[model samples]
Target chain A: MIDFERLRILTESAKYDVSCSSSGSSRRNTKRGLGNAEMGGICHSFTEDGRCISLLKILLTNKCSYDCQYCVNRRSNDVERAEATPEEICELVMSFYRRNMIEGLFLSSAVDQSPDATMEKLLDTVIRLRKLHRFNGYIHLKGIPSADKKLIMRAGEFVDRMSFNIELPSERSLKLLAPQKSKVGILSPMGYMATEKKQALSLKYNKFLPAGQTTQMIVGASPESDGQIIRLTQGLYKKFALKRVYFSSYVPTNEKNALLPTSPVGILREHRLYQVDWLLRFYGFKAEEILDENENLPEGYDPKCHWALKHPEFFPVEINTAPAEVLLRVPGIGFKGAYKIVNARRYGKLDFLDLAKMRIVLKRAINFITCNGKFFGTENQLAVKNTLLLTSTDSVILSQLSMFSNDEIRQSVLQGEI
Target chain B: MITFIFDGTKIGLFTCVFDAYYERRIPKTITDKQVQVGFYDNVYQIETDTQKAKRVSDCLKNCKTIGVLKDVSLALKSGRDDKFTVIFNYVKTVIDNKNLDVSKNFANESVLAFSDLIKQITYEVHRFKGFIRFEESVDGYYYAHFSPDNDITWLLMPHFASRFSNQAFIIHDVKRNVLGMYDGYNSAQVNAEDRQVTVYLSDDEINFKKLWQTYYKSVNIKERKNHRLMKNFLPVRYWEHLPEKQVEIASF
Candidate 1:
């Protein structure tokens, strides 16, 4: 049996990896394996940044070969190190799972020995878990970049998810900061995995790398703007049909890494990226519409609010009259609310008071809407801008205050209550 | 003054909306009776027309996506009494206008307001999915009771049936007094009054619950004790319905 000490260390070490969503996988139980990846509610415990850690999110070993500056397990950092045998890990996971301590396993590792050897150990652990121990619970294994493609492909068939971290957005900064990790090492595996998963899904085989592939890019680690990060996000989603691209706000874990940002990334920029990500997933707003590759998203307001301020004539839309699509564009009237209006408005005329009853943030929406042909907000562009700025400040204050509320802090973290 | 009192839910809301928008009927009852005074209170005795009700349902069903159906259900479950009817009626008018105008201009203030209510309702549905906890009864039936912020018991029915089909279950909406029951084969509705809250358990059922309770205890990371986080997402009130409460109590 793997000692509990090694298990905790390995799992906690892997917690920083964010790609843990279980939706895309369709693997089921076979006579040989003991578990399955059902699509229902076998969810990974995702954090505020949307990194999934619910599974036994851990690494086989924390010892590293490469000196990636942003990594906590970087070569020069001299942190305590531990490694587990494949048999021990398999035994640990099976025991935890039998007790229902975990729904699945999220196994990742640092570049120990060599990338090839690290990849082999990861594969060995999963193979032991599945073939030897009959431990089939959802397994998300990380691919060690620069590891051989044959090993990567063989590993993909056994595990549900495989991610190769882009780590930074641009190739130039990637070379500068993470010289040991190459762009090709990350992108090629992702591209190949995407194509293979598609082909597997089409052929109705348990999709090879069932949840497909996801990559994480550390924001503010390099000087890449939000626009560049988002462009990469959009391109990945469009080209790879990637399930999600998570943003980790760069917090310099290593003090010696001069290439890294000294202070933690402003949470608001992270918040903006999430809101922009929401636009990409639900609302039809493209990355190009929200920000440019050279420019960062506005820190003052959400992307929707910033976009609305840019276009003035669209305002004072009649609340009862606005189409669901237009209602979604209004900063406060979310996509869900827009659809509600489409359904409920069929019965009668709506007013501002009714909007309040629906729990919409009327303070933001009121400026842009008219209730029963009555306009209540400033039409003057300057006045609207000034009022919006004041409201934005208040919103920040509200945002901070709101986080501590029993409802906000708890439910938000558990359900990712955004 | 139309003294047309329909069911005290979204259907009631829709009925009031139909009378006012199409039949020019006035509301005799409201959450605030003062609003119905003078001009708002003037009564036109509602001539009950099933035709109008059918017409309203047809029009709503015609324009209905999965979203609007939820709004109607939410307003029903909201139990807000008369104003819910007011919101429902306003929403109907917006849908009709969509057929005519198909643009933002046609929806007006009331339509948008109705839409916004649907948005909050959807959030409630999403919250319900996470908050819901099933406890096995003595009769071997799994039961979950919730007083959601919005009326969405019916909306939550399909999710439970798909996720836990083999188990016999009851999802009760305490506020609306409605329950969605599934015997696995046929998932159907039952009134809350008919539900008997039983605690009797056979040996096998007790054994299963014990095993389930046993499994629930082992998974948590004891060191990362975020009790504040736990209590916040799941308020203390919900513990009464969960089978694993004693373990949580012991841990604390």
Candidate 2:
């Protein structure tokens, strides 16, 4: 039987790795299976830290050989250690699935003895879950750095998703902080998996990592600027076709180290990176246009609004005639809003009131759009900038002070109501 | 002013729409059976006929895509006072105009309101899927309880039935006095009129609940304590149903 003490030690040690999302895979229940993965993932609950709990994210063993400074499971730490057998993990997952407590399983592990041995044990649990237990729910396995390439390939066939964390931004930092891990040890498997996924698509081999791969980068752990981090993110998406790249704000776990900072990285920096990521993926903004190579994203305004303020020539696009791509670049217009405008304009000419009724964030969009030859925004650029600054500052302060109370403000933020 | 009243059912609402169309007069208001009648309005009580309801549904299916039928059905389940009127106006517009793409016709208030009402109900269904928590009972059956703002018990049945096909489970919406029971093979609905019912949880189940709460507390980083954001994702209204949100007692 798994005791609560062992559970506490294992889950606490695994908490620092934040990849809680369980989306991007769909599977039907078999004849006698217990669960099914919905097309859009289900978030079971949100913890006090405001992060999603979609999967039973836990480590197989909290015993490591290599010592990574930022990691909680490092060998140097004098924390309590624990390990559970494969049968114990299977039993825990089945019980949780039956209770509707979790949607799937996210199994990671420390390098217990060796990378190959760790990967073998992780593979055994998933293989048993699928074949022996007939568990058809989602499973996301974390690829161990420097693990055998053949083991990674075989494991990919059984699981829905896999991730190899590019922990630090640059190679120099990896050598300094995490001496045992190298850049080649991480990127080789990522490159192999990307190629295999592509070949699987062409050869009609379905169910080879159906949910795709995602990686995480520690934002403030290294000295790389936001510009450098975003450039790397672009390369990952462009080259590997990554489903997502998560940016975790560095929390001070080991403050006594000389290389690491004593203070925790603020959440606002992480929030800014997310906004810039949205601009890259959805808004069709290139990394160069967003920020310079040496400069970080501005803390004062959002990436889109910041881009708008820098280039005044792109403003005042006619709402009725601009294409969908142009509408997406507007400050307040989002993917949903842009599509709504494009579809509704086919029926009749749209104005500001109609836009409001359709859920457009008119406060921000008003300055950049002209509705049917009439402009409701300030003609002077300076006045527009000041107005935007005032409104944006109010929202930032309000969100920082107390969130979730005001429905209007939340809707405004959701609908790009900047 | 003419007020049309019908039984609180989807077929009854559709039948009321049929009556409004055949009579060639739009009622000032449409309400379900539970709603109180106005003091000075001319009230018309319409009995629900499946044939008439089928005829209205057939017309909707024949006129537009199946998506329109889904929206109308969801709108009827919203439990709104004048939802029938909103759907009636929307269906009439779709049937009257041949070239009108009702999906894009946000300019029409009835179509817009009908779609928005449907969106609200569907959104509630999606949210409850994630928010519902189940506990194992002494008899080895799993039970979950929730009180959603929208009447979405029926919509949630299919998802749980598919996911927990091997387990016997019951989802009880205490506020609506309705329960959806799934017993391994088939699922059924039970009317829970008493509202006060309890389940005896097993010893291991109680301990599992404590373990889950402990896991929640352990995973939380104190520096990122944003209760506001937490409330935004998991609202305060849902705190009662969550095991993590419950206050721990020293009895164990």
Candidate 3:
């Protein structure tokens, strides 16, 4: 068994990495292997911070060689260091997996000794877990940026997903905050993996990063607007075919660093960015359509509502006749709601009562939709804006007040408006 | 008005549907529990028959394009009192409008109610897949205990059976008194209304539990504590069985 203290140190070091999803890969268990990956991902537990603990996210070692100013495990820091062997990690994963304590392993490590050596250790651990241990569970490996491309690609064959963190968004921020890291060092590997993954897919190969790649950027660390970050995200998705782009709101771990902000960036900004990210991915929105190149996402409203309010000519879409994409743009109707409307309207015309029965949030959607040629919402745009703002903030206060209620009310409150 | 009582099994519920059609009398209420019958109300007891059940099941499967049978099965598994009436009314609608696509018509109250019930049951099944935690027993077998809102212990068998193909484990639903057991090669479910067994943990189980508890604590960023969101995902009912949520008392 791995020592308790070593596990704590390694886990604490890796906690700041925000990508914990085990989705998109559906690798099945081999003849005698232990586990398999589900396509929708399974979150085994949620921590006190409300983050999902899908995988046993831990580091092989916390010893570092880089001195990134925002990082707690920088080389200059005097934190206690520890390392674990490949065999020990394998044993720990197997035992925890058998007992259903975790879904799989998320193996990351600081640049211990050298980048090449650290990548070699990760590769060795995954290969042993696959070949010697016969474990077929999900494994998400962290890519060492400056390591050799060949070694990183070899490691990709054994894991489900991999990530390279672009901690600072801009090259200037990279130089100022993390002088040792470079934009080229991060983006080049992502480009190389994207090309390789495309080639593998063309040849009908399914072994190279079956879940594809993802990268994270610190939101409030350096000076980058939400619009700029989102455009960069769009480029990464279009260029590298990344599965996800995560944004971690910067939390101050080091004291009195002149380069980094002492006060932490609040999580509401992070939440707004995620809302905009969803719009870009699923809501048929372009980054430019959501916001300009420099303006941050508005704090008072969601991206979909923000876009809806700005284009007044698009208001009052016919609920019965609008296309699926138009319904998606309405303030309160989600993808599921739009689907239900499209299907249900095929049989008969949908009215406000039918919408309410379908659980569509009519409070916000009433302002944007006309049901059977009847409009119930206010015609004034300012009044509409105030109503939406009041309801949105009302939910926040309502959720807070109901925090001590019984389970059923709490569940509905958590489900939160359609 | 007439009341039809069943045996609370899938076949029993289907038999009620069979009798209702053949007798040509729509039941005011279909239930498995005993209810107070008024003087003007008619009461009927439903005896489960395989032939009648199969006939109704076959008609449902004939509309397999819409997966009516699947909806019926999942809806019946809910612990709700009105599940029988909800499914019966929806199945009647599908049969009444056999030529048209009635299942997609969410404007119909019966169809909407049935869809909502299925959604609830399916969401619970998905939640339990992650919420179920297993502990190693002394003999190297794994055991987990949970009390889900729906009778879904059996529904979880196929998922874990394929994932843990080489391991032996048992999942106990304390509320429903049912046990889903998988023994390396095959899986089965049994009733455990009066079953009792003492479980002794392996020597290393305590050590691993402590390690997991410690890891759970360390991974949380204190700067981003959001208990509302935590309770939203994890919920208070599930915290009872989770080892990480249990406060450890120091033992001498």
Candidate 4:
């Protein structure tokens, strides 16, 4: 058995990938092998950081030949390294799954010699977990860049979700920082799988990657602004029909790297970006509306507040008359709140008082909305902003926002481990 | 001389703590009305007597504060304004001196179901107790915050205080925004205030964050990193605490 020390290293190494949603798979458990890939396989449990602990998150090995400077496991870096064979991973995953330690397997690895070689080992383990072991569970397999499309496509069929990280926001950053990777190397496979996911789903292939594709882009590593990152995020969601766009904050592991930030990218900035991302996807606000290409997201307020403050002309929208889409544009009202307004308004005209009963954050919305032609909040934009900030319930609102959108909030809501 | 009176019912703005209670328990039984709404109407005065509201609250609070009453509510967790109203109304009938023992009198399936939910929420908090990992801030403070369903924030105190006894650490329930600070010997839990403790930005965690990020990026499968799946697992909302979420330049 690999020692707990090695286990910790391997699991911790795989923590940042953020591509492990065990929602859909059809693999079955074999008597000899240890697990299965079911839609319900990954029972995610989270900590305050919103990192999921349910999947037996591990790697085939941290051993690598590729020298990606951003990675601690880069071949040049001297770190405690370990590799698990196809069978070793199978046994560990099975044991962990059986003991109910995990809901699924989130497996990845550093490139040992070549992308193909690393990917083949990853596939071999998944294939073994399915064919030889007949283990069915939720398996999220990471796609190796520059790995053969045939192998990548094959693995796509077996895993519930597959992700190819658009690691940096742009190709130049990829070249400047991670010279070994290219625009084509990471994106070609992603393009192929997006099509494949579409084809499989279009055919009503329920057995296909049910959770679908997602990609991560490192924020603040390159010279990209929140607007650019968010625009690319919008494109990914729109063009590829992606389920999510993850923004991993750049942690300066190697201080001397010229392309990377000398210091860590602030988490609050990353948090604000996520809020903007939500507005892009769920809120009617476009990336351009949230922020211009020249500007970054406001450090003090979220993108929604920024937009509301910028366009005072949109303020004081009647809650009863405003459509669901327009209602969603308001800072305080979320998707649920919008739905409640739409539903409840059918009975009668809604006022500020009615909105309060619905648990709506009228502090932010009241300034922008009129109830029964009555306005309780200040008409002055600055006054509204000050009042909102003054009466602002920081933890409560952040907590509520986190509940629906924040990964950290999901950790608290999502039940079960593995 | 002829006199006429106008009457109608209207909902009003503003609410005290007990508005939700009346919204649920008060029957809309219009058994009696003095006049017609099309012409002369009866003015329905909105209730706003704080003293009267307090009496209703005092009774309800006493009924709810009892563990047995809450245990009977079957919410599975602490009654934090949701579905508690349902139970509060349902329990009102039997919440008296003659029927104080809820378990003995009404130990039905509703009670059992709520108990199960409580158990499930308890299990989740316990799991978080083991799963939460905090990075060392520059100032030698270990800060980890989570917004759990239950008051799992307190559940963490005994374990973390004993585990990191020598360290000054804070486990903030980001959801509740109430932080529990363990100063080695004593644990004082409080809400986040600007003047209280340093609302130090992410700069504090930057000094020692690289190793974790490096490890994180390295292990991503070049073939299969699903951003959506990852978001589903560890949503970006948590990225604020995770040292790695800030920035990473992919060194090709």
Candidate 5:
């Protein structure tokens, strides 16, 4: 068994990495193998910070050679260091997995000795877990940026997903905050992995990174607007066919560094960035359409609502006749809600009551939609905006107040009765 | 008003549907439990017939636009009291309008209620897949104890069976008094009312549990402590079986 202290140190070092999803892979268990990956991943637990603990996220070693200023495990930091062998990690994963403590293993490491050596260890651990241990569980390996391409490729074959963190959004931020890491070094491997995955799929070799690649960027670390971040994220998704782009709000870990901000970035900014990211990925939104190059996302309104408010021409879309895409653009209708409306409308015309029964947020969407040409929302744009803002804040306060109430109130809140 | 009483099985519910159609008397309400019968009320006890139930199920299956039978099955597993009536009405609608996709017609109260019940059951099954915590026993088997809001122990069997193909495990639903057991090669469920099994932990279980608890603590960032969000995902009800949430040794 792995020592408790070593596990703590490794886990604490690996905690800041926000990507803990075990989704996107459907690798079935082989005969007598330990586990299989579910397509819509399983989150075994949620931490105190509300993050899903899908995988046993831990580091092989916390010893680093690179001095990235944003990193707690930087070479100059005098934190307690610990390293675990491949056998130890495999044992921990198998035990925890058998007991159903975690979905799988998320194996990341610092630049212990060199990038090649670190990547080699990670590769060795995964290979042993797959071949020797006969474990068919999900494994998300963090790719060492400067590692040899062959090692990274070999590692990809055994793991479900791989990621290389692009910690800062801009190259300038990379130079200022994480000096040893380069934009090219982080992004090139991702590009290579994407191409390799494509080639493997074309050749019918389906075992290479079944979950594809993901990357993370630290928000508010250096000076980068939401638009800049969104643009970079759009480029990553389009260019490399990346699966996800996670934004970790910069937490001030280090002390008195002139380059680093002493105060941590607010969690609300991170939440807004995630909202924008969802719009880009699922809602068919473009970064340029969402925000300008230098503009940050507005604090009061969500990206989708803000967009809808600005474009008054799109309002009063007929709920019965609007296409699926137009319905998706409505402020209150989520993807599921829009799908429900489209499907339900095929049988009969949907009125406000029907929309309410389907659980569509009518308060925000009422301004944008007309049920059978009967407009209930205000035609005044400014009034609509104010109402939207007012209702949004009202719901927030209501939810906060409901938190202290009984389970019945909480259930009502969940059902959107409030 | 008439009440059609079933035996609380899928076939029984289908038999109720079969009776309502063939007998030409649409019951006012359908249920599985005993209820007060007034002097003017008509009560019919549904005798489950394999042939009649199969015919109704086959008719539902023929509606290829929607998986009506699947939805009925899931809705039947819900813990709600009105699940039978909701499902019966929804199934009757689908059978009556076989050409039209009645399941998509959310405007219909029966379809809406049935869909909501199915959604609740499906969501609970998914949540239990993650929330179920297995403890290693000294007898070289794994055991998990949970009290889910739905009759979903059997639904969880295939997932855990495939995931832990080599391990022998038992999932005991404390509330329902049912046990879903897997013997490495096959899975089965049995009703064990008021059954109790003492599980002695393996020698290494404590060590691993401590390691997991420590890891859980270390991973939480003090700077981003949001108990509300955490509770929203992993509710307080589920914190019972979670080792990470148990305060064994309070960290001062």
Candidate 6:
């Protein structure tokens, strides 16, 4: 029997991984199967840190041979180690899934014996969970850095999503922090999965990996600017067609290493990266255009607002006549807001009140857009910058203050309802 | 000056809409028969007519007013004040204008109000999907209990049904005295009080729950503890059913 102590240790070890999203897989339950994956994903619970605990995120074993400096499961770490068998993991996944505690399993291992050995064990658990146990839920398996191509490919067929953690943005940082892992070793499996998925598509075999691939990069671990980090993220998205590029703010787990940052990176940096990521993915922004090669994103304002501030010529576009793409470039006008403007404008010329009703964040947009040929924003660039900064900071504090008192605000924030 | 009390189902509400449209009478309020009318004004009881309901349903379906009918169904279960009137006016606008594009017509009051109501109910439905927790009963059936603000017992059925298709499960909505039962082959909703029983979890299941609760605790980073943020995602009301939120230390 698997004891609670071991489960606690494994879960504690797995908690640092911020990518517990159980989305993007849409597998129906076969007869005699215990579960299915929904495309929208279901977040079963929220931890105290406000992160969604969507899956049974646990490592098959915390025992490892490689001494990755940033990893808690490194060979030199003194943490107690335990290994779960394929059967034990299957049982836990089934039990938790049936009770609706988790969407599925996010099974990762610490290269206990060897990379291939760990990869094989993970593959065994997922295959058994599917064929033997008939558990057809979301499974996000971690691809061991140097695992065999066959093992990674076979694992992809069984799991919904697979990820190879980049950990550090650049190869130089990878060598400094995690000696055993390499950029080539990590990118090889991703390249294989991407090619296999394309081949599967051409062959009408949609069974390769439904959710595709996602990756995580630890921010602030190595001395890489957000510009360098985002460029790599763009490369991964373009190169691997990754489902998502997760940015985990570096938490100082080990301070002994003088190479790594002694303090954890502030979450605001991570938040800014997410905003930039959203702009890249949804708002059709090129990373190079958003930030120069060396420049870091500004702290006080979001990437979009920062971009709008830097270029004053794009401001005060007529909302009533601006095309959807132009509206999207406006700082406060999100995709949804842009769509609303296009849709509402068809009926008649819109005013600021109409924009407000559509839930457009006009605080920042008001500085950039004109309603029905009337300009409410200041002509002076300096005044506009101060106003935008005050509004952005005020909104942040306002959200924190208002969210503290109102349950609806807090709930909306969680649901992205605001 | 007139209130129409219907059977409180989506069909019943639509049937009332059909009747009100035919009669050319805009009702002061459309309320469920179970709830207090709150007024002595002229009250009419509307028995659900499938034929009448189908006419409205077909019209909306033919026009393919995407999300308008869905919003109507959600509004019926919304339990929000003046929702009936808002839905009625919104439907009237859609039918009158013959416009499927009224969804984004924020300038229209009824459309705006109905959209807001639908957004709320939709959000709640999505949240409940994540918030619900279950325990294994002695019969090996998974059972969960939830108290949702909206009458979404039937609404949440398809999600859980597709998820646990192979397993027999029961999701009881404590607020509305409803239960959604999903057998291995089929699924349906029933009155909770109609079928009552004492259920005891198996020892193995209980131990797993303890482990889950323990895991939940271990996963939280104390340095970044944000009670406000946690409550934002998992509201305090939902804490009752979650095994992780239990205060008792695990005996195992």
Q: Is the docking of candidate 5 incorrect, acceptable, medium or high quality?
A: medium
> Lowest lDDT 10-mer window, candidate 2 chain A?
A392-401
Question: What ranking of all candidate models by TM-score puts the best one first?
Answer: 3, 5, 2, 6, 1, 4
* Per-candidate interface DockQ score: 0.06, 0.61, 0.72, 0.04, 0.73, 0.67
Q: After superposition, how far is residue A289 of candidate 4 from its true place, in Å?
A: 2.1
DockQ-based class of model 2:
medium
Clashing pairs in 2: none
lDDT of 6: 0.83
lDDT of 4 at B45: 32
| Tens digit of per-residue lDDT, candidate 3, span A1-418 | 6898898899999999999999989999999888999999999889989999989898999999899998989888778788889899999999888878788899999998788999999999999999998998899999988889999989889999999998877889989888888888898999899899999999999888999999999999898888789889888889999999999999988667887788999888999888888887898898999995448887777878888888879989999999999999999999999989999998889999999999899988999999989999876665566556635338533234344765635554466521
The superposed Cα distance between candidate 2 and the true structure at residue B22, in angstroms, equals 4.6
Task: Find the 10 residues in a row with the least total lDDT in model 4 chain B.
Answer: B6-15
* Each prediction's TM-score versus the true structure: 0.65, 0.91, 0.93, 0.61, 0.92, 0.89
- Please rank every candidate by DockQ, starting with the best: 5, 3, 6, 2, 1, 4
Poorest stretch of ten by lDDT in candidate 5 chain A:
A390-399
Query: Where is model 6 more than 4 Å wrong at Cα?
Result: A390-418, B1-29, B32-71, B193-197, B248-252
- Tens digit of lDDT per residue, candidate 3, span B1-252? 899998988888888889999999899789888999999999999999989999988887666337887777778789899889999898888877777778778888998888888988999899888889889898988999988989999899999999999899999998887999999999999997887846787887788888889988999999999899999998888888888888632221
Give the per-residue lDDT of model 6 (tens digit) for A146-175. Answer: 899999999988999999999989999999
TM-score of chain A for the candidates in order shown: 0.85, 0.92, 0.93, 0.87, 0.93, 0.92
User: Model 4 scores what on Cα lDDT?
Assistant: 0.63
Better of 5 and 6 by DockQ: 5
Scored against the true structure, residue A182 in model 6 reaches a CA lDDT of 88
